[model samples]
Target chain A: MFQSDEDRILTLITRKLMGEATSSELEELSLLIADNPSYEILIQSLTHIWNTSPARDEDFLEATFLAHIDRMKKNGCDFDTYEQEIEAKRPWYSSRKLLVPVFSLLAVVAAFFFWPRQASVNTPVIIAEKEIKNEISTRNGNRTRIQLLDGSTVWLNAGSKLDYGKDFGGAKREVYLTGEAFFDVAKNPEKPFIIHTNAIDVKVIGTQFNVRCYPTDKMVETSLIKGSVEVLVKNRGEKWVLRPNEKLLVENISYQPLKKERNVAEPVRARKVFVAIKPLTYQNNDSVSVEAAWVKNWLSFKDESFAEVAQKMERWFDVEFEFRNESVKELSMYGTFTSESLQQALEALEFSFGFKYAIQGKKVIIY
Target chain B: MAAYKKLFHCLFPSIQNFAFSIVKSRQLAEEIASDVLMEVWVRRLKLMEVANLRLYLFTSAKNASLKKLKQENRFSPFSLDELQVEFISDYGNPEEILNGSELEKKVQEAINELPTRCKIIYKLAKEDKLRYSEIAELLEISVKTIDNQLVIANKKIISAIKYFVRKKS
Candidate 1:
């Protein structure tokens, strides 16, 4: 197609507007525009239009990015692992500054655990042999189900930890728990699965059970769903056998020992470790027990006080709650929440309890 | 990590818009954009060897969008003439320009009436700030074609302004 000079000038001008024109092309454009002076206004208008930027909603963009991150996580892309892998791949000299303190802290912990005694000085050397301990933990608002080497499956609730040695499932099946978990022990007559907690130990041959031993809770609870298990209270040195649908509650001795030390002046009241056996809580014909509902992604509470439910909600939603009015904490609440967002949950609670609450970032203030 | 986030915020919308031009679905476009950006993170070390990261990302988005269309059984080998490209421009204060809102409206209408290929080229050049060669590489066309299409777009808008100028005189 034969192009006119007018069309040629516009092409060069467009290139010039986009900063794509060379110095020679620029000179050619300027000369062509000078010859057709009437094109000056059109060129100026085009430049003005090109310079104007489209309106952007930064907050919307940020929200979209965060949602994208969530989708990535749901798709099994763990960014935290990638970050650690990248850090590990960095040059040693560059990583040494950050690794030094972490290594020193590990050394101190190791020394405390393996300190040599006068008679057993040689034992420290044997104990220093590397024993790989596998630890799996879940952050608040997240739950994980992991299968053990023994074919047993364990579901860890939010804000829980399950630690086991590398030799687990070989000669001994033992795990240390700091929070809540549900276990379905694989049947192994030779090895009894044992869970060690701060206040008690749960021993079972083949059973389905749930254990709740959060550090913030006042008691340790073991709820057996299908099979029998034995619960040993550490402070009381008593073993209680639990039948199916039985739940044992033992007062946490970790906090009470410190309280007893503080109140030494008082007469020694025989504070036998408070212990009780009760039936597992079931809600309105639901086969799933309230105690183990979290395994199924439901946060269930049965006639629990608002204060107790708030603690559960904190882990379930990864939020901090501040109760401004003390009376609001004592209000008995009962409900099951599965997939409601924090805002919707709060609104439902507000409608029923008539409590005023405000959510600021990750903190919820109740009055 | 901060650099990755900065890159995401800077490039996501533009990539999404480009994909939207091909897929014609906002949700699918956003998904394609996310997938493309995530690939950058996945291949961060390898991508450092790429000469033009922006062009690489745009090309990835284009391929992903076309793949998504194919998955949905809507794939037709992309023809620039068949694509519906949306061009959005912010004329800050129309009254400050020559002959005010009438000319601005005319310019907008002219942009709307532009051929699909011409509008896409114009948008990539003006809004996305892509060079002529980059646009040519992304769209799989020659730089001469881009140069001519851009002239066609500009001539249409300039004639809109000239119409108003003639009427006023």
Candidate 2:
């Protein structure tokens, strides 16, 4: 029980803030504040503080959820098997319809691994005349340089795969990218080059650009360096025209259709997606854009949070990072690392950020 | 699996905040919440045996946060008098605090200055928008105790603001 009048008043204020106050209590509070002008400040200050606390911040909670999902997957929770179990109970036609696109992509990927290339075999030039689909992949902790048949050059980042059809330079120059790459296409007015990613389609006419759309990332980013590009967001019917030194970011929120009401006739629409366009960042005292710096093997970031930087480091070094301390995620970092070993990079970050990290086998835990 | 994911989404934010209030560190709070959820996911088949999932989650978050605090050597056993003094005193300059359009920031800092248990109860009431009875059930405390803690939180916030004003004068 609140014995003192001041204690009772404070309790009433708390009740009011929680929307639990009775009408009599509300009237009493108003009278108390009216009788004493200073009580007005007390109420106002408490209200402001209650409303502005970081507990009400949604961004932090969203990041927490994403981190939880990442941890669960890392622990080998077998989410795919669980998903398959649910999908198996669905109608047979529904599952069959879903397999069409997947099977086609698998066929393309299969052709890439087994087809014999005339350049590799000394037997016959007939294989060279036949149109051949080529697939180029960079394994973990490695990057590769590739020159296409049309003299275009591509620098593929680590853990990335790019596949092109047989008629690459004939009528349409198109490539499907699964991870990240920097593309420098040769000029060809008759054919429009397209870079197809899972989230968006980047169409260009012989230009240099960077596309980063990792499956684990929450957004797809495309930064143009030398020429123009029109980015078409899949199923969104939205197009973004990007000029040189421009970047487009598309948030990857998948569409979840209504299940119970399957008979309703509604046009397929993208549900509440987000996109942002901004100027590409330029590294200081250099002509190169920050987005395209990976082409030169320079790991550079400008004002990126530690969590984001950690993801990049994971792919760059092929190591697993386990964050034991959450406060370190919000720390903003900016630097350039070129050819540094994983330990050296971690050491540099530790010195700059004043956080202690321990390396055990392939896992780096920051506390 | 979608049902499990939905449950996780609905409950994680409040549980994370609850842990943060106990630990007073964002990283520890996130880790605690994630660890609790990981346990739930690993023993998902046994989840049906638990009658009250929300209370289970809150308990897990609280125990894990306290354990981590102890492990980090940051936990000091508290007394009622110590908590009262902590809730009522210790604030810095007004000139640095009372800046432009940062009244919200000042208020947030005041909330952060609250005693750990008081802050957690206030968040359960205000931020999570849980009813007093609901929070009492989750924390396994009396409803009257929840009411007293919320009042303590409001009083401490006002005291912190007054501390700034007196310093300015």
Candidate 3:
């Protein structure tokens, strides 16, 4: 196959050693090697290097072994004789206190093995009501805000508590609350919201509203900010519809029938009271930004007395406040101020009134 | 003192002789063997599951020495592989020797010197043990191409050994 003498020679020599060669060239090398042994010796050297190339690296192997030993030691697997020696000298195991654990373990074993049979035979089953999952309780002056999975947000005012659970199962999104909170609920027409307070249940859909039910207060109030709500009384079965910007204040009172009239009865006129439930309102003026002013870091005081402000400050600064004279409670203020510093806000109130006040300990002596 | 004693035991005595047999230089063998062993220590994590630790370690050293020879020979025309004298050391007992680093290396160099087609066909025919027909089927060329690679690979190795042998004689 080779054309020239040099190519033929190269092919012939390669074939002679039985190393590697083309079939035609290989036939020539065999002819050459069969005639001469010198070429065969050269090919043996090439195969020698090929025999063990994969394993020629030594230090690579040693480093590999030492690393394994180090890893085993790192795992705290060194339970050597030193630990045994320390344990053998300890005297606490034979003490009576050790018997307590043994008995306790025996009691637990007894409960697992025996108690269920006795309880199943003796006690009747009573299904208990399940509790709501999510809860929020705000501190004295802070607004606790939470966004539900449905993208609805509940802003719990100071001294308020709220409880809700997985949004809705089949019928409606229901929540129970105490104290005061404002809710901005997402509009889902298929699922309406119902809030259960101590006095009444407020139900709505696609609405923003506030519910204030202070235990000490004489009335429970619900104020609709954007949409509609219906308040239902528990025993009376009375339903009151409150519209946007309208309010409802139901007195915390016992249901009493009107006193029976004694004298001559005049013909009763067609009554408006029979048709419409009387609406309730606290402010003769409009409700302003003061509703959630605390969320914006503003202390909104509307016709708030000095005593009321002092009560708030005491909780905010973790101090006790005492007024020497009762008339300090009569000095009321109306304004909005952010507390840059606790002392500065208090000074601003004092500055507005031009009143003399002393701060000795937590007691404010205002004259 | 304890650390020094531990290191003394950890050191492989087989490396120098093994490297010497491959690269055919005592000094280069020692350096290659030690460097390979140190690197083995650095990357010991990989060989945690390896069986036959001693054989494994010495083989790594032998590879390092052979690599040094190949790299050095690439630039300068000098090779430590003097053929006839180095043969017995290169083809030492596969079973009896703790490592085959020396022999593996010489085979590699002899093949590295082979022409392209010779290297491939020889690799296919001998190392892979493919028949002429099998190699032809795989390469999809004529059996002549496969036969040419084998012939060239063998002849190149044969010539390299002859040079070494002739120089010694």
**Per-candidate iRMSD:** 15.2, 15.4, 23.9
The candidate with the higher TM-score, 1 or 2, is 1
Q: For residues A1-367, could you state the per-residue lDDT of candidate 3 as single tens digits?
A: 2235435655554333333445577556446544555444443344333332122233553464455345434644342543463367432222233333222222222211111121111121121235435676766655566665555777776667887765443356788888777788888878878899877798887788878775644456677766688888654568988866567776543222223313433322222112233233211111233444444344555566776676556544545555556665776655444443455555545434544567776555666
Clash totals for all candidate models:
0, 1, 37
Kindly report which residue stretches of model 3 are placed more than 4 angstroms away from their true locations once superposed. A1-132, A166-171, A252-287, A308-320, A356-367, B1-169
Top candidate on DockQ is 1
| Alpha carbon lDDT at A269, candidate 2 | 41
Best-to-worst order by lDDT is 1, 2, 3
lDDT string for model 1 (B1-169, tens) is: 6445645766787789999999999899999999998887777656545656677788999999899999999999988887778753355443245447777788888988998889899888776666778899999999999988888888998888889888878
Q: Per-prediction DockQ scores?
A: 0.16, 0.14, 0.06
Docking class of 3: incorrect
Candidate 1 Cα errors over 4 Å, as ranges: A1-3, A82-367, B88-99
* Model 1: TM-score for chain B: 0.92
Model 2 Cα lDDT, one tens digit per residue, A170-229: 777899998899988998877888999877999888899999987767678999986788
TM-score of chain B of 2: 0.61
Residue pairs clashing in model 1 are none
For candidate 2, what is the TM-score? 0.42
